[model samples]
Target: MTKRDIFISLALMCLWGFNFSAIKLGAMQTDPILLTALRFTFAVFPAIFFVRRPPEAIRYLIAYGIVFGLGVWGMMVWSINLGVSAGMAGLLMNMSIIPSLAIGYFLLKEHLTPYKILGAALAIAGLLASITITDGSVPLKALPLTLIAALSWSLMSFVVKQSKTKHVFAFSVWGMFFALFPLVLFVFIFNGTQPFIDLPSQLNSEVWFSILFQAYPTTLLGYWVWNRLTIKYPLSTMAPFTLLTPIFGLIGSIIFFHEDVSVLKLLAFALILSGLAISQWRPKKVEITSAKLKSECK
Candidate 1:
């Protein structure tokens, strides 16, 4: 990648990392479901005028929207509310990569190399270690909810991979539109009568700033840039950069939330990073040729 590409990747990582902090801020003042609904509502506004729908199967687009927007964000917000620290949430969410790879292998029939298998095992082990070190005492009873979020994300990845649409931003925008109704229902079911009617006014400037930051930079702009990057580069090349997001989340948490980072957690982080690197590392040219020949012969 060029220096410019590297800079863009770094900026993307920063945006995602800071997103945890933003979630924390939003959760403090508004109900999680309501907050999630509002975030998407904000995201959909600009796209209404600018983004065009792709000429593809409507089902794929709708499924993508549901999984990516409503399902993932719904569970994630609930998890954050339940007691998953923003930093921890960021770290644990990396677990979605496992399911994504699994889905690709089983459902999509994509190749899974030994390196990827080993990397996945190591990453999972690291996650287990983190859970154990934290005494499995997830706050707000958030583990299950977060796991749902992870699954949603994995499913969304599959949806994106299967989408016939070439325009990523358009898919993202349509996703927001599709998700709005479900998110509204969720908010109604959870928030009841005393909704975030006062949320706008009650939120201090810092919180509102966090909300707008999340809606625009993290949701809209970040997705736009990410879609472009994915189009320009191979998935393997782009996948590793995702690991950087959690690093930013950790740093941001320590700085903003004053979260503790124990030695074990640090060790877990190292193992996870190593696992991700190993998974994404390309094999030698000869090995690639051999694999290709073998597949063709089969």
Candidate 2:
């Protein structure tokens, strides 16, 4: 990656990191699923007006919408409302890489390198450590729910990869179009019309900030830049930078929500981040010659 690309990736990661705090903020005010619905609504309009639909089968788009919208994000916000702290939620959500790798290996027949295996081991260790934490951040239900969110993320990845759409952004927009109604339906069914009745009164500046920020920047612009980066760089080059999201997430939570940091939390952070980092790592290959002792591979 160029220095400019590096900088752009870092900036994007920062925005994504802070998104967890935003999710917490918005979900606190309204039904989590409804907030996600608003996010997709804004993300889809005007922008989706200009974007053409992807050529993938309708099933792929629908599946993409379902897993990406409700599975990954809807569940994530709900998990926060259930008692997972923003920082911890970010940390747990990042574990999607594990399930993603499993999908690639089992379904796509991708080979797993030793580093990735070891990295996964370390990450699982971090998760175990998280189980031992006494902080109220990780409630009994919160961990499982967040893990479901992560798994949904992996499924979303599968949908995207399986679709093999050159027009990724278009696919995302159209897919999310399918997701909006389902989300609203879920809100009405589970919570009743009361939240909807209260919707007008509930959408204060705090809620607006949270929703619009998530809609425009985090969902639309964030994915746009991310898709561009993935096209320009090797997946390995791009993947490690995502670790910054959780780090920034932790920082944002501390600043915005005063999330407590315990020793166990630190250990989990170290393990998970290290695993993700190592999973994406590739050692530089050195040239071997009988006559020449040393040569650098570029």
Candidate 3:
């Protein structure tokens, strides 16, 4: 990757990292579904003008949109509303890597190296340790919702891989539109007219700022830059940069929410980072004449 691409990738990670705090802030006043709805509503305008939809298989696109946009965000919003800490949520959501790998292996028939397996194990273990070591009691009620969010993301990743779509931002915009109805239904089923009608009219500046940041910076610009980078670089080269998101999330949590960091949590973070590194690490190559000959024949 070029230096500029690396910088863009880092910027994208930072944007995504700060999103946890943004979500947390928005949750303070806005109803979760309504907040999500408003986010998509804001996202649609720029997307409509700037992004051109890819002419690809409709099934994959619809599937990607539903899983990624509606399913993931719906569960995430509910989890946040049910009292899952944003920092913890961010950390746990990284668990999607496990499912993502599994999908690649089983669905796509991709080869999995020993290092990848070990890395996945370490990451899962670290996540478990983080949860066990928390000082405050975990909200069991929110656990299911959070897990659902992670699964939704995993599914979305696979769906995207399966999709014939060439334009990620365009697909994302359409996905948000697809999510609109389901999100409204979700809010209606859960909170009914009560939360919808009773939302605070005293909309603080912070809330609006949070919404705008999420829609424009995180969702729109972040994805745009990220998609461009992916197009320019190989997936293996680009994938490792995502590890930075959780790091950013942790820092953002500390700065914005004053989340306490215990030794155990730190250890867990280290283990997770180590696991991610292990998963991506390449072994030393030993060139062989026979291998070269076989490649030439193919």
Q: Each prediction's TM-score against the native?
A: 0.88, 0.88, 0.87
Q: lDDT tens string, model 3, 124-204?
A: 888889888876524888888778877787777666666645787787777666777777787898789877677667258
lDDT of 2 at 53: 85
After the best TM-score superposition of candidate 3, give how far the Cα of residue 196 lies from its true spot, in angstroms. Answer: 2.9
**Model 1, range 1-298, lDDT digits (tens) per residue?**
5679868987998889889888888787777777777788888887668877777688987887688677788888778877777778877777777777777678867777787777777777877787778743367468878888777877776677677458888887887788888877877776665775766675787667767887899989987787677556544445556766777887888898888889998898788788877876666897789999999999
What value of lDDT does candidate 1 attain over all alpha carbons? 0.76
Ten residues in sequence with the least summed lDDT for candidate 3: 231-240
Candidate 2's C-alpha runs over 4 A off are 1-9, 227-242, 286-298
Of 2 and 3, the candidate ahead on lDDT is 2
TM-score of 3: 0.87
Model 2 scores a C-alpha lDDT of 0.80
Off by over 4 Å in 3: 1-10, 200-202, 225-243, 286-298
Candidate 3, overall lDDT?
Answer: 0.74
- Model 2's number of clashes is 0
Clashing pairs in 3: none
